[model samples]
Target: MKKILKQVTKYEKRISVLLMVLSLALIFNFCINSASAASGDIIYVNGSSGNDSWDGLSAAWTSGTNGPKLSIKNATGTVNSGGTVRIADGNYNGINNTKININKNMAIIGQSQTGTVINGTDSAWIFKIQPGATVTIENLTITNGNAYNGGAIYNAGNLTVSEGRFTDNHAYVAGSAIYNHGTLAVVYSSFLNNDADGGYGDPAYNFAAGAIYNDGNLTVTDSYFSENCAMYGHGAAIHNNGVLIVTGTDFIGNSVYGLGGAIYNDNALLMANSNFIANVAYAAGGAIYNIGTLAVTGSNFMGNVAYGAFYAPYISTAGGAIYNDYGGTYTVDSCQFAGNIPQDIYNNTEASSGYGSGVITGSSDVQGATVKAANKTMPLQKTGMPLIGFISAVLLVLGGSAVSKRR
Candidate 1:
């Protein structure tokens, strides 16, 4: 009996050791999976005939290839909550409303702008973001999507775009290429050849903003806006109904029919170290039209034209570079308005006085271009970062528990 008991004890000890080894192996495997799910901080694409890498994720998406081709949807995107969604170098195709909505605490990074493309043309936006969700779209091309408001993108949360092309998208009414109602940050992006009919479009109420429309806070840094045509009226390149901050951005070769050849501001617009060149407005405001506060500092406004057959004091008027009417104020500081012919600043009617009466020059009382200088130096914010510590900590805790079991 004593010998039998000894044998049983020895076998029990061996089984315990085997269990510990198995537990340790599981812990190690889990750790490796947690870290290796996403390769790098970026989504890489090798070569492209202008196809987005997100297309690869769509192949694995549950939508079965026929639905909106999304790299990450609500289901799969929720996996590895902090993991990144990578895209290979390939052409991704979506008709309309084919967007990768970033609702999780993750990032959707890209390889290069020249190697990716998002081509969608339907009734919904190509990229749509919800609130509290941060997303960054870098080094890609987004075009040919359709929305009632935002053609290519509609952002309700914080969004940032860097080194990409936004071109040839068409919105039903407003914001042909992009419509922003939340915080927007743009860097080194190119807005080219988007079309939106701004409220006087054919068939009535067909309005569009060729390049962009912002109803929230917007900051453009070192970007270029060109070849956007608002055939109906207002904001050939941009229509801003909220706060617009432009720093070191180039607005050139844009056309608007009614007002603001390059831009139309119904609210606050601040331009610093920017350039508005070669823009044409058919009715009024060759380069810019403001119905609210328009501030310019250290910016260049050159070669803008207002092509109007008949002119009115406030209606069908023309200004070389700028025109403001009814409760709008224009402030200039260290800004060169030369080569912007036919009176740089034209104010038709003011809340208190007539045109040109509301403009307050840099008198001895005001020192310099405060508004312009501030916007010019406006810092670009970074967005679309996930809560990396939260999920990673949880994973670590699980792994540690498994390791302890082994011990």
Candidate 2:
């Protein structure tokens, strides 16, 4: 009888331990389920329905208590314009169907572009900014958003960028860092090592605009674009189809397959107190390929090359350094265009197809004070105006600081 009683006691102890383990497992499973359900909620990208979510203190988005916690963690989710999504800081290294669709005013505060990354791989761009939507981005270090156009960001409407570093971003068509069709303004923004290498994609043309392929109005002030490259055609740094204004900026190490290693302007290009250096091109205009009128005041374009079409190297060659094709003209003052090697200075109609117009040593200073320079007007958009400021603020928060916003 004693042996039998001992056996029963042993079995009871084992059963009690099993029951506790099962209870803990059930609790953990419930918690995970709840967290996942919470992350699946939808939000807007940047449009507004006349309602703002950045102001007002609310936690739960629905009841205005505890704002919903955003956790993707290799999971799939959709972002419209509704609430703020906190990336929680980690490598979103998979193709997680994660998107910020333009619907309402939305803000995505990721830790710096280098630390907190959103790899929208397995498809196209990491963040695809849709048309007719206003998007504001800050403190987000976004890269490897591979697409034929707008590798990192493909904007169709109004985009304001501040304090973000678009590095190693690429596009096959145009605007490796940003392919803008509507309007764009970059203030205090740094675009580095973004490539505009056009390949055998749709249309298959030279659309690689190192930093931007602006067909509309583009305004860049107090920005830095360096080591950016383009495949074929104008303005390795900027292939502007409309108006472009540069103020207090730096363009360095920009290259092109054809013309305009530093800049290729088709419509109008204007600059003030800017610097362009160390840019190269395979064809004419190692520093500038202006098919239209290129104007600058208080700017410097030195250490540029204009390798002429001829085989012999002319160290003092001028036009090769600055090529203005199809009757392109320039009015520059207080600017430097030395260290250029051009086949001819201007009107080398015999050098095959390219006809360089402006040289470093000659041409207009102010074809008159007030000319039809590239329209320096930036696209009008409210909420986070002057993209550079917002970019800086976002970088501050993303550099490992925990984000705790009330709205």
Q: Compare the candidates by TM-score and give the number of the best one.
A: 1
Write model 2 residue lDDT over 181-249, tens digit each, in one string: 755667777887777666632345756687788886677778877767776545677788776777788
Query: Global CA lDDT of candidate 2, please?
Result: 0.55
Candidate no. 1 TM-score: 0.68
Distance from true location, Cα of 210 in model 1, Å:
1.2
Range of the 10 consecutive residues with the lowest summed lDDT in candidate 2: 398-407
lDDT (Cα, 0-100) at 100 in candidate 1: 55
RMSD of each: 24.7, 27.1
TM-score of each: 0.68, 0.63
